[model samples]
Target: MKSFHDKVAAITGAGSGMGRELAIELAKQGCHVAISDVNENGLAETVEQLKAYSVRVTAQSLDVANREAVYAWADQVVADHGKVNLVFNNAGVALGATLEGVSYEDFEWIMNINFWGVVYGSKAFLPHLRASGDGHVINTSSVFGLFAVPGNGCYNASKFAVRGFNECLRQELELTRAPVSLTSVHPGGIKTGIAQSARMTKSLEGVLAKDEKSAKDNFDKLFITTANRAALIILKAVQGNKRRVLVGPDAKLFDVMVRMLPAAHQRLVTSAARKQAARSGV
Candidate 1:
């Protein structure tokens, strides 16, 4: 965990955002990267970028929600790299809607990729990482996971579940003396294409058009952190053996608020979200 040099890292969602930046950074540090994503074009682009670094880089199309496919891919990674030192369960999507307004289809779609994908990634790569005797599981959560949001119920649910699951996994690993450790990542509004590229169903499109801020508004107001910065923070947290990682200034603020003043934090978040919803005409 001190260094990524020569280590083998398997990263889900490596096609873009923090995932892509992690792969690039790890490769620069001489770590072999196994990058997988459903976006073949973006995956190929990431692979091409990684080739400039002096490390092994493998790119593959993977749907992390597919448990069987994830297991098969993990097995192949272990076969190819001989051992897996890191598994980043970072694949996720955003679905913004009120609980009542969010469609069952949208909820299921987001859960399948965001929550279930993380579960499958963790389970699939765990054995290989354990066999290596030096491994870390980094699961992506979000600020929404820490607090309830007005129009992001589905996203919050998935991320909160991830945080709970990873916390339990960390405890079990400690009790059993497992070689692998876990870190739940809470990234606050990185400038990823998550909002622009989010899966907005027809039912939710009306709301999005009305209140959810245009992509430009999101970029300006919500997305204050860069993907590369987020990736660097993640690596540092891993090396420091942190149980939880806050990837942006906003995330750090929320972490402190929730820990130091739970009641006040809850009220503040609720009030803020209500205000946002009102502004959006939701």
Candidate 2:
């Protein structure tokens, strides 16, 4: 869609980070925004911030992992706004652990929100979006979706799944001749609280506490983009109807690297991860 004015966008994980930024930006562009997150306090803060813009804003506490809740929220959003033009399956969590070290519980926790949440959001909002006849689904994958990191197997898996799912969803939309479009987003380390805010499994806790300095140093090197800038790029990509949007230079470079030299890229990533672990004394 070339314009967002008067359009209604439903966003998951809208309390903070890219989601919050998206809400504010869309509201500024005169679009009505329905923001949802499990963090009620954060959702309240987002609502307060969005008040400056003269647009309709709705906030709800949501746990995207809950399928019923997600579906209900989708219905409620359409009921509240009369139509839904965009659905941003942006709810996600970060988990870091080697495949061997990660627990099934932790893995499931991440998957519910990261992978299954996308599924729920897409399916729940799809019918309404089609009925609206002006719809787009924006699924948030990560640069980790493009490349695997040794200590972040859980995160990597979920993101990769999201990427694949959204791609297929896009193709299906095309076949049906639906006005709905799908876009997969791969964002490089934007300065979000994900590092400090993500749920930690025992394995992740061990690494973070024992090697906090090294972890911080490594992240400092990789985190190069801000959430606001990432949101701007994402909005532009949506307007341009891009099938895949890479947010940051790091994401773009890694996307190319994986496509051109998958094996070599894997080796490079492995080496770098090992070096970081060694430096961290982990």
- Give the Cα lDDT of each candidate: 0.86, 0.88
lDDT of 2: 0.88
Q: Candidate 2 on 18-107: residue-level lDDT in tens?
A: 999999999999999999999899899999999999988888899999999999999999889999999999988887666887788999
**Candidate 1, residues 1-282: lDDT per residue as tens digits?**
899999999999999989999999999899999999999998988998998998888877999888899999999998888899999999998876668877788899899999999999999999988999999999999988897665577888999999999999999999999999999999998988787777544444444335334523533478899999999999999999899998899998888888898778778867775565456565
Q: Report, for all candidates in order, the number of backbone clashes.
A: 0, 0
Q: Which residue pairs clash within candidate 2?
A: none
TM-score between model 2 and native: 0.95
Give the C-alpha miss distance for residue 279 in model 1, angstroms: 4.2
TM-score: which candidate is best? 2
Q: Using alpha carbons, what is the TM-score of model 1?
A: 0.93
Off by over 4 Å in 2: 202-209, 212-217
Best by lDDT: 2
Model 1 residue 257 CA deviation (Å) reads 2.5
